[model samples]
Target: MPNLPKKVRSKKLSSRVDLTAMVSVSFLLIIFFMVVGELSKGKAMALSLPEKYENGWHHWGCGSGSNERTITVLLDENNKIITYTGFLFNPRKAPKEINYGQNGIRKELFNQKKAILEYSTALGKPKNGPIVIIKPSKKSNFKNLVDILDEMAIINIETYAIVNEFTTEESQLLASK
Candidate 1:
């Protein structure tokens, strides 16, 4: 019988998975999400606050029937805006819901501003712009507030304020319409 040489067996080598690509991809995803979250953040609006006090807080003008130089806008749901020249108790212009746009609130503001300027001129007083009071209701969204602020800016109104507190009458008024 011929002698046969036995074949030598080679040792098995273990295969390792490289996680470099996965790690890189994960880092990139994290960074992308972080950037997206930052971008999705709400942008803030700039506000200019008045001094401590003013001489014409409630009193708009000196002459009678000429004090309709101010208007209060109550923002409600679905872009509903309730506007009045004075308080709901004794409104100079009355409480009525107006639309939102150049033809709606903008035109009203323009006419009111024009009337105020004319009144001041007739009274031989300075042409101070009309005042606007913005009251955002509970049901009103941020967009509505922003739109009103934009209108105020578009009208070039100098005196305007965002009031958080709402009176009972205002609440009822907003609920009615």
Candidate 2:
């Protein structure tokens, strides 16, 4: 009888995986993303346009009212802003280019507002601030419009309009610069 040789055998390991931790981690990640999405929100600004008259003219002026209390701002290309007080044909203050920011249009607005209030008081009329008329030409970009609107808001300007129409003289004025 021959003695049989003993064969070496390896032990079998378990194939089952623990999915509990993975499921918990995935839920935590989902909740974290949801919270972040809710926290981040977009901000916006509000704009109110004036009504048009049957005569193809817009009801203008604000605060104290009257045409002489109006400040016309013409936005042009190359970041140019031409400002004049009262009517274009016969202006109380002639048109001139002004910059943006605190020193430029902002400063002018403050001065104009103060002057209009004083003028109204002296005339024994309603003492109100100036009415700003904003005319942005086709050459101007959207950013210019937005920046000007922001400036108006920052200046606490209550009455302003975005007029699209431009006269021949306005175009010529824009071209002259």
**Highest TM-score: which candidate?**
2
Give candidate 1 regions above 4 Å deviation.
1-66
TM-score of each: 0.63, 0.64
Model 1 lowest lDDT segment of ten: 50-59
Which number leads on lDDT? 2
lDDT of 1 at 41: 100
Tens-place lDDT per residue, model 1, 73-153, is: 889888899888854567788888899998999999889888887876776776656778788877899999999889888
lDDT of 1: 0.78
**Least well predicted 10-residue stretch by lDDT in candidate 2:** 55-64
C-alpha lDDT values of all predictions: 0.78, 0.80
Candidate 1: RMSD over Cα atoms?
A: 7.8
Query: Could you tell me the TM-score of candidate 2?
Result: 0.64
